[model samples]
Every structure is written in structure tokens, then in C-alpha cells.
Target: MTQYQPIAAAAAATEWWRGAVIYQIYPRSFADSNGDGIGDLPGITARLDHVASLGVDAIWLSPFFTSPMKDFGYDIADYCDVDPIFGTLTDFDRLLDRAHALGLKVIIDQVYSHTSDRHAWFQESRSSRGNAKADWYVWADPKPDGSPPSNWQSVFHGPSWTWDGRRGQYYLHNFLPSQPDLNIHNPDVQEAILDTARFWLDRGVDGFRLDAINFSMHDPSLRDNPPVAPGAGPRRRPFDYQHHYYNQSHPDIPTFLARIRRLLDSHGGRFTVAEVGGEQADREMKLFTEGFDRLNSAYGFNFLYADALSPELVRHTIDLWPGAPGEGWPSWAFSNHDAPRHVSRWAAPAERKACAALSMLLLMALRGNVFLYQGEELGLPQADVPFELLQDPEAIANWPNTHGRDGARTPIPWAADAPHAGFSPARPWLPVDPEHVPLAVDRQEEDPDSTLNLTRRLVALRRREEALRCGIIRPLDLAAPLLAFERGDGPDRLLCLFNLGRAPADWRLPEGWTVIEAVGGEATGGSVPPLAGLIARRSA
Candidate 1:
């Protein structure tokens, strides 16, 4: 009975994302046109053909909005316009048209949590207390001792409050001081964001990835957050010491998300996925996307922050989202803009090939919308970006403390021998990883067994199999070193087995199972070789 549920829901018109594949493009690193050091909208437009070739259903672009680049484009100055460095709005139009032409839906990032202080709205809000726009941002009076209103810490490394002489009050910023949080409690602010969405929807964007949406609202009382015990998991910064209760995860966030959903629904078939991170992410993600009135899905940082991949970790993470009723759909990504590449993080130098193939296979087999970051198909490892070339603010600030994002964000290598690895004719804003040159798309395209080709085959495999898409994952109790699960829905059912360890694992296939696809090393109905991943289908 339960197996028939998703199969029924999967047939609905709005369920395109139920098992869709999304390719994420960090615009500035994807490609460069006009010989500029920076990649622009035209560059991404030229690369749509490649993304479409991977058989992904849609594309999720990291922020390319008007910004001062404080936190890259996550700190938006103009929600409705493309940043000059990323090319004009017309360039984006062409990109959207090309993406649709290739049958790929375009999903842009929307940062409603905060706006660049340089934004017209924030500038006016900070001008004077009695001004019309002053209350548009989060403004609170200082304590009698002129101290900050609360003990809330900014994610960047300091007090969340910044004193403003112009307003004679402290404005709250959950991130960088230059990026002030919007007062989402204000109806006008909500309308402004909705209008921004309307502008894009009317212009033809198919969807949006709401950035830090869980932080869209804050507790109005400005209560001090209680500290976590000392020595909380790798506490390198003050921001990691508290529960972050009063600063984010406000109860009212779902209301605003519903408004966003309503607007997206007005445009028809438009999707909205929230980027929900931090403590209480699971609960908040459910609330933000709980029903038909909210977002379609939310992706957290489970695998993104994991140190290693194992049977226990994979099982635990999969169980986190069980597709329970009233629970929103979940999305998963092994690598993305902010995350270090899994090929480097999870595999040893010699085992890199096996790791890439097995990981890609595992990622695609999971039951959710999967995101494949640019170059992930090519198994690009994290670049070793030296300190001199660091561009990411978080990376630079916590240099020795954190893994830093610059390594994973280095420009993609399109051609092994081309200048700047064919990312740009001029020097790129961030250095292209020398190691990535050998794994360039051009070189991998020549070899049928390359990770690039394997990725395409796996993508196609997932697309054609009903059991692989929109099915429920039933974890199988296997011994250590082997991970197995059965994915089933309606008339389609398949068994997936993975040998996670370096040694061969015994696995005589069940009586009725027949091999469908095998990679890394196949299971020959007797033993599964090291790093092997196999899919066996059940005969109807």
C-alpha cells in the first residue's frame, strides 16, 4: 500500500522535482566570455549545452545578482538586476532562453535573508530612525550600557549587532556587517521580495533557490542565546559556541515561505527550494516546506559537512528524511559551491577513480532530487589554492581553522591544453587548479570509461528506471563494509548493493534478482569486488 503512494503522487503535474536532477553552476567559475577574467551570463549561456548533455532536468545557478561581492553574490544589493560583473540583464535573458531551448529549467538563487548595505533599501533604512524606511531593517535599541541588544553572534565572527550613528540604534546582521538582515516581520519588506520574485517569474525564470531562508526572520525579543558547552565539535570561532536560537530559526519563517510559494504558484510549475542550514535544520526545513502552501523542497548540510562516507553515515543520513506524511520532500548534493569536492575529501589519491564512480552512483541512486555541481561529472578534485589567491571571505577569515571554500570553487577546466584551461582567455578571478587541467572535460570526453562518461550513463540509468526515481528507500541490514538497500514503488523494484571497503565482500544475489547495472567492480552473484556498486532489478 505504501509503495503505491509515491507512484500515485509521482504522476501529478507538480511533481517534476520529486526525482529530478539539478545541475548547479557557480556562474563565475563555469565559463568566461569576452576574455574577461570573470565569467558572465553569456559564459553560462554558452555552457548550457554541456549541462543539458548530462541529462539533468534543471540548473541551479549560484547568486549572480547585483552585489558588492562582500560574501560573493549572497549579499545582494539589487534583487531584481544582474550584477555588472556578471553581464547585463539582457545577457541573463539570453541564457534563460538558451536553457529552455535545451529543455533545462533555470533556477536562480534568491537571497532574502539580507541585502548588501549598499542597496537602496538598506541605505535609506540606515539613514535616520524617524525616516520612512528606517524600520525596514532589523533595528533595536542598545542596552543602557550601550552594549549590543543580545549575545547573538554573526556567522562571520563577531557580534550580530552593529551600532549605527545615523539611526542611533544597532541593526542586526546575521552574516557580514555589510549585509544587514531584513525585517521580514514588516509587510512592506515581504512585498518588496515578492515583487522581486514576480519580476523574475514574469521574465521567464522557472524557479528559485532561496538562500539562508531559515534566517529570513528572527526572534523579536532579542534574547541572548545560551552557550553550548565548551569544546563543542571543533569550536574554532565564537559563532559555533551558541545554539543560535534567538538569531535565527524564528517561528514566523514559515509564514513568509508560504507567501513565496503563493507567488511561485501564480507563475505555474515554478519551483522553490530553500537552503536551510545550521542547528534545528531538520525541524525548520519541515516547517518551511511542510505542505502545498510552502516550498517544494529544502536541502541541508548533512553530506556537505560530513568528514567521510560510510555505511553507517549513509544509512543515518537517508533515514533523516523518511518521506513521512506532512514532511516536505528532501534534496541531496554530495558537492556544491560551498562544499569541498567529494572526490578529494572521501578518496585517497590512488582510489580517486573508484571513489568518484561509486559516489556518483550512490548519489544518483538515492531517493530525492539530486544536484550535480559543475565539474562533478568529471570527478574534479578540490584544488589546492594557496593563501595568495584566496577570494572567499569565509576562507580568508578562518584560513587555518577551516578547509576554506576557495579550493572547491576554482574555475572549471574545459580543455586540458587551452589557455587558463579554457575557462577564460584572461587570468581568472580565482586561479584554476593546475591538477584539474588533466581532468578537463575535453580529455574525459575521449575515454568512454572516464568518470565523465560514467556520470552520464548513471544519469541516464536513473532517468529510465522508475524504481530509481520517486521510490522509497528500504535500508537492508548488511554486515560491515557493505551497504545495501532496496528501492521500490508500484510495479518497479530494484536492489542496490555497494562494497564500501577496499576488500571484496560476499554477496550472492537473492534468488530473483538480476543485474541491471554495475560499476566500480561488479557483483557476479558470488562476490562483490572492492569499491563495487551494483543495481539488481526484481522481475515482475
Candidate 2:
């Protein structure tokens, strides 16, 4: 018997996220409505048709809730309400209705670890020691010398603890000082989070992508982190000088994940994916989604942070997720708002187009669910954001040493000739790059051979073939630069191969195999051209 059944049936069985193609939308850069220089829910609603045309199953919207925009919506001020800048709650409802009508599931970002300084919860928690929500956030007394409680450093800058005069104590902030860490160990806080989840679930949300989930809980003892060994790598900031043991990845995370899963399960059909980033991300990811009682999936920074994409890198990343019973399904994305684009990281000046095509094809062919970032389909390279225009805090602070994430977050050009490339009537928060104008969606829509079309073809193949959708992957033994794998080896089988080197790699399409999709130069039976990929199938 073959695992070649129609994927549509499996999709209808409430496990649509298992092998679904999720497109990530960085709301601020995706589209702008109201001529306010920022993308809003209405803007996203208008673009849903374009997204649906790409054949993706869902969209993972980045944070867009009520916030101060200090960390660009990650520092959520209100988890249950829509931010005014983005739009009103009514606007979000409209967007959801439109997306569901298009047969596209919608998932939103949930930042559980922290809340913005402007959030009512944080404000109350900081008001006084005896307030009802005084202990809702993590707070610790300072050391004898009035320094931070521990050596834990924040991801953005200096110490993780900030002095709060109101409480006469120091509060934990794993990111910006304005974003206070939630005390998930507190039972009241857990219930509060669950209530928040229910609020959205009641509104008919399909899922949530938990942000920095591992940071939701911390060691109650307030212990210092272990110092890093000498010369591990270049210490970018104080945060890089420690092993990050006590401050994050607490054992209680899985228990909370079980609570989250149970809550979503109560909703009958929903999805949950965690974003776990750190040195122990792999271990934490497995633990968080280890069984049926936890999250449905989790994605690490494997491909997102890799300096180069290669056969060995893909092989190593795939091997981590077995896709077997009892093992959690893995979700993958090469680029997101937080990281630089893959083409920028993997290819130089002239090779971005080929690199983008190859990576897109490869992402869709993988065994588990995959996410495609906005603008990736257009083969848009990372825009050059100089110091004067840099918006990302980390990038601004680490200028020259690090290019940061702003380059990859430039506004997506809709029309090649329009002012601001049709992004908005007014200037966008992020400038539209001149180089990206030629790669606009409208321009690609006019060319059948464009990377955008390649994405559509590849995505259509994923939807049409069970082998590429939900089938198990088996790596084929091949020399360097030639990565090959088999999907659904029984019937309706597939052999997906990629040539990652500068030169073409030889490969013969097995007898009786039919080409499904090919991209990047000629993907003929004789060879897979450099920076190319081929998906071929065999039918009984």
C-alpha cells in the first residue's frame, strides 16, 4: 500500500498544519492602507488574494497587536486587542473573514514571555508591591551593591534586570527594558494567559505561533548564568558572554505547553507552533513538542541563521526531525522578519535569483510544514539599509559589525513603476529599494519564468503530490554539492534533488519517472544545473 492518498482528505482531517505551506507576513512591510505609512489589517485583507494564488495553506502573521512598537509589535501591550496603528478590532475581523473565505487558515503571533511597558498588566504589576497583579511579572531584589540580581543579559542590550522604583525591586526583561518578563511559574499568570487564548479562540482564530516561548519561565532562584568559555566566538554584546542556562529554557515550559495544547484541543481544530531560539533550542523544541499533549510543531533557527545553504546543512537539519510516531513534526523557514533573507546570506550579487529559486523549491519539498516569507517569492534580495535609515534596535546598536534584520524587512514592492513601488500613497516606514522595483509582484506576474511563478509551480506540486506533502523523507547517498532524497517510496514516489554548488551536478532521472517541477537553469535528466532543484515522480 502506498502513502499516496489525496492530501485534501488529510487536510480535512484536522491535521492540515502537518504538511501545510505557511506564508509569513511581516504586517508592517507587507502592505499599507489609509496612507499612514504603515501596513494595516485592511492592507493585509486586500492582499489575501495574491497570497491565496500562491497555493499556500495558511499565513503566519507577525505580531500586530496593541503595542508601543518598540520591538515592532513583539512587545505586546494588549494581547486581546488590535493596535490602532494597524487598525481596529473590526478590521481584523474583516481580514479573518476574507482569509477564511479564501480557504486560507490564519495564525497569529503570541508573545508569552513578556509584555510591553504600556500594557495594563505590566503597569499594574509595577505600580506597587501590594497590587493585585504585583507578582504577575518577574521581579527580584537587587544585590548588596544595588546591581542587577544576576548576570543574565538581555538579547538587545545590557542587564536583563531593570530597577523599578515603584516596587523597590528589579524586574526581569529578557529583551528591551520596556518589555517585562511574565511570571509563568505563577498559577494566576498561567490562567491569565489561558483566558487570553480563549479570547482569540472564541473569535475563531485558527492557530498561534508562540514567540520566545522558552523565555516564558525562568529559574525561581534567580541564579546567575554560567560564563561562556574563552574565545567561543565574537561576543557581539553582553548577552553573548554567558551560556544562558538559568534565565531561560526552564523545565516547566513543557507543562505549560501541555496546558496550551489542551486549550487548543478544546477548540477542536487549531494549530500551535513555538519559536525556540537559543543554544539549547533543538533540545527545547523536542521537549516542547515531544508528544501529543504538547504543541503540534516547533521551528528552530537552523536554516534562518545559517551563513550558507548547502547539502550538508539541509541534511543535518532534516535528520533532526524524524517525522515518526511519538516524534513532533518540525516547521521550517529560511527567512523571517527577525533574520536576514536566505538569498542575501547564501548568494552574492548576481546569484540571488538562482539561489532564491533553489531554496524555494527545496523548502516546499521538505517533509514537514514549511513557511515562506513575504517578498521571498519575488526573489527580492536584502535591501541595503544604511545607518541613517536603520530601524532595528540591535542593528542600530551594532552598526557596521552587523547588518541586522532591517535589510530583509524592506517594504515589498507591488508595482515596478509606482511611487514607493505601490507600497503606499505615502512614504512607507521602511523605504522601498530601487533594485527591488524590477522584482515587484506585478513585474513577476507578467513573466511566466519568474521566481514567483516557480514558487507557484512548486507549491502546486506540493498540493498535488502526497509524496511531497506528508510523505517521509529518506536522504539519498550522493557526493558533495548533490543532495538527493526520496519521498513516499511506495507508490506515487518522488526523487527530489538539489545542486548547491557553483557547477552543475550530474543526476539521471530514474527510468519511468516523470518531471513534476524543475527550476534554476535546465533540470534535465543529465544534470541539475548549479543552484537548481528538480522534483520527479514515479507512478505505478
Candidate 3:
């Protein structure tokens, strides 16, 4: 008998992301197969079993395309080819082949918003005014005073345009100057991006995790964004002090998304998930994933870049879309390549590991697709990377304010005692923290109650429970500082309670509720006289 029994069951499968968890592996830090101190495709291939064992539905590999490593592989020189630093096309095929064999769906990052200045298309576009690809990228003429097209600001700081003397025009770059934004308004440009998607689809990729999809289409008129008054907290950067009306979140983006969705639909059930960020993410996430005709799902930076993790905050995030209709789904990720590790950001040393483990349980209990970063299961805290060893351009450019992304991009420690923590025999690209040495996979593998075990069990538990997967969420009114909710599938209901405070809190349930998974403390009946936090299953 096959694991998938019927064709129709597979075709109409709610298993697309039904309580499914995705593991995000930053390629450069995952594993170094050739010991060049940098990770390669083969390195990831060598570790598919580790990922499969974690009970995740899929694995999302970050950018490995050819580039100058200016913004680490986010600046793509070639969209269809793998970078030499990460091995060859053959290596990626082998990795994908192996991952599929282990029952893991492979999803690769698609950076369609921008391309590196060194890309052939951009090179040709900049060469002349009447070139075949002159309109392939966002090229604009200078204003009356010779300033950029608009006052748009780059995410990396300073202005969003850089002068290109060759073309006698300014290029719009939402990120670094080298990362010129693509012209999505042009039909040929959209076709080229779709063709790039097809290249990977032809290689048997399960789906695509679109990087900054909202950034693909910008305001064609180049309208200036109005200044925003400082709201709650002190404004960190000038970029945050604007409504960002012009630079991104254009009305025409949904049409482009529908076009992309049509292409993916041609491949028979291939999924598309977008990464929506910036000030308007809350609004854009809904717009980008409004209908099934557009993106299958979209995740925002709501919880990822947060400094504090409270029950109320988590509840508010889930309540953002009470009952999302049509094809739009929400994917939640607490940690990723960007931002500091959640362990260090949310908790202290003594309780950080336990709190991190509990977070996994909470994430699994949530009513959305969950994305787990590679080292998150092992409770890996953000490591320290000195300025001398930092390879991240963002960190180097905005050193004092941003703190760079290198610390979170360090090598994944497979063995505590191995040379370079079993990531590489030679010195890794980003140094692994000495404190992270003991928290390696090998050490946690044998321990049943370790964070690794908790991740595996929680994922498995979520998979088994129907109410926990594709059910409707009902927020329960519990005491203060405690987040409680009920996930119900008709007759079955699961009551989830989380004590956000440090002290023990009593959980008063209305009726019959059985404690299923307890995080820290105990629970009894529908009410626990002294309940810390727990996940309880109930029947109507």
C-alpha cells in the first residue's frame, strides 16, 4: 500500500499545509560538504534525514543563486542557475531528489522583486535606451534638481536610487543600490520572472516561497510618499516615518500575483507563498492573498521582528483574520534568516531554552501554517559574529543600529564535539558560538525531553489532531495575561491556554475539558486551580 492511498484524496488534499510545519534552512550556514567554510547543495543533501526526522511537511531553502554575495545571496545575478559557491545545478537536483525520497517537499526562495546589478538582463538594460531589455528594470529619469525620481528610501538606509551614468538614468532599488527593482509593469518582465519559476518547477520543486513579493510592483507614476508623524515609540529610521504609499503596495500587484498563480496552476498543484513586510504588511498581506486566484498564502514580519512575546500579542495576530475565505492562507514564522533568534530575543539564559521549547508547542498549536528555522528546534540562540568575520552586507552597512543578520545566519551545529560543530571541518563562513556547541543535534537527539523531541512530538501531535489543523479559531475570554482560545472542528474542540505572566495563574474553563499537552504546570477538570499554561482537548 502506498502512503497516499487515493489519487482523488491526494488531489483534493487539505494536506497542503494542514497542521504542516516547514523548516527554513539558510544554505550558507546549514552544512559545508566540501569544507570550504561555506555550505553547498551537497551539504544540505547530506542532512535531509535530519530534517525529515523532525516531522515537518516541507523544507524551504533560502537563496542559493549566483551573486557577488553583496547582500548574501538575496542579490541574484542569475535566477535560473545555482551559485558556484553553493555547488552546481547537478548538486541541487541531487539534493532535491534526495529530499523528495525522504518524503519532504522542497520549496526554494524566489527573489522576483529585484535582481543584482551584475545580472545579464540588468547589464543589457543599462547599456542603452533602445536595448531589448531596456525596460526590464525600474529605470527613471532624474528630477529637475537632479535628485532621484522620488524621495523613496532604501531598506538598507539612505536613498532608494543610484545614478547609472551608462543609461543616464536613476534605478529604483528598494534594498541595496546593487539590487535594482524589477519592472513588473512590463509584460516581458513578468514573463521572464514566470520563466524563472518554470525553470525550478521543471526541476521538480514542490513550490515557491516568494521573497518580498509586494516589492515587485512599485508606483508607476513615482509619487512621493507623505511623511508620517511619529506614533507610539521613538522613530528608529526615516524610512519608518512614512506611510510608504508610493514605493510599494501598488493596486496593480494583485493582477501580477494572479498571473503568477496561473503559471503555478499550470504545473498541477504547485503552491506559492509570499513574504510581505514593511509598514503596510498587515494591509498588504490580506491584499496579496485576497483570493485563491492570487498567492496560495502569505506570511508577514508581524511576529518575526517582535521584541516581546506576550499572550495578548499572539492572540491579536491570530485574530487578524477571523475566518479567511477563499484560497488565502496565513503562514506564521517566529524565526528566520533575518532578525535575532527568538530564544535570545524573548527569554533569558536560564529559562530561554525551556521557554523556546514551549514556544514550539505554542506555534504548533496555532491555527496557521508554521515555519520553523533550522536551529530553532535545537533551541539555538543567536550567536555573536565579530565585525571582522561578518559576511552580511546589511550588517556591515548599518552596523550600530541594525546589528546585521550574521549572528542568526551562523552554521547549524550538528555535533557538539565535531570539528566546527559538524557543520564544516574548516572554519565555517560565520563562526558558531562556543555556547551553541553543547546544544548540537547529536546531544539533543538522544534526550527524549529535549527541544528537538518537543518539536517532533508537537508537530506529530498537531498532525494527528483534526481540530488543531484546519479548524476555526474562537478566542476565549480568560483572565488577564493569559491567552486562551478554542479550536473547534464541529464536535471536537481543543482549549489552549498560555500564561503570559511569570507567576502561576488559575485557568477557569466553562465545562468539560481534558488536559492534553501541558507546557510547564498541571491542570484539572475544566478549571485548574493553579495552571501555568496547557493545551486541553474538549468535546461539545
lDDT of each: 0.87, 0.88, 0.83
Give lDDT: candidate 1, residue 75: 88
Query: How big is the RMSD of model 1?
Result: 1.7
Whole-structure CA lDDT of model 2: 0.88
Candidate 3, residue 178: the lDDT equals 90
Full ranking by lDDT = 2, 1, 3
lDDT of 3 by residue, 1-540 (tens): 111111123423644754468899899999899989999899999998999998888999999999988888999999999999999999999999999899888989999899999999999999999999999999999998999999998887678999999989999999988999999999999899989999999999989999988888899999998888657444555566677888888889999999988998888867788999887887788888875688877886888988878877886787676653443567898899998998888877877776776678778877768899989999999898888887777787777767778889999999998999999999887898998999899999989878898888888888777667766677777766678877755457788887766665665654676777876656544444322467777644
Rank the models by TM-score, top first: 1, 2, 3
Q: What are the RMSD figures for all models against the true structure?
A: 1.7, 2.6, 4.3
Lowest lDDT 10-residue stretch of candidate 3? 1-10
Candidate 1: list runs displaced more than 4 Å: 1-7, 10-14
Q: Work out the TM-score per prediction.
A: 0.97, 0.96, 0.94
Point to the candidate with the largest lDDT: 2
- Candidate 2, which segments miss by more than 4 Å at Cα? 1-13, 523-526
Worst 10 residues of 1 by lDDT: 1-10
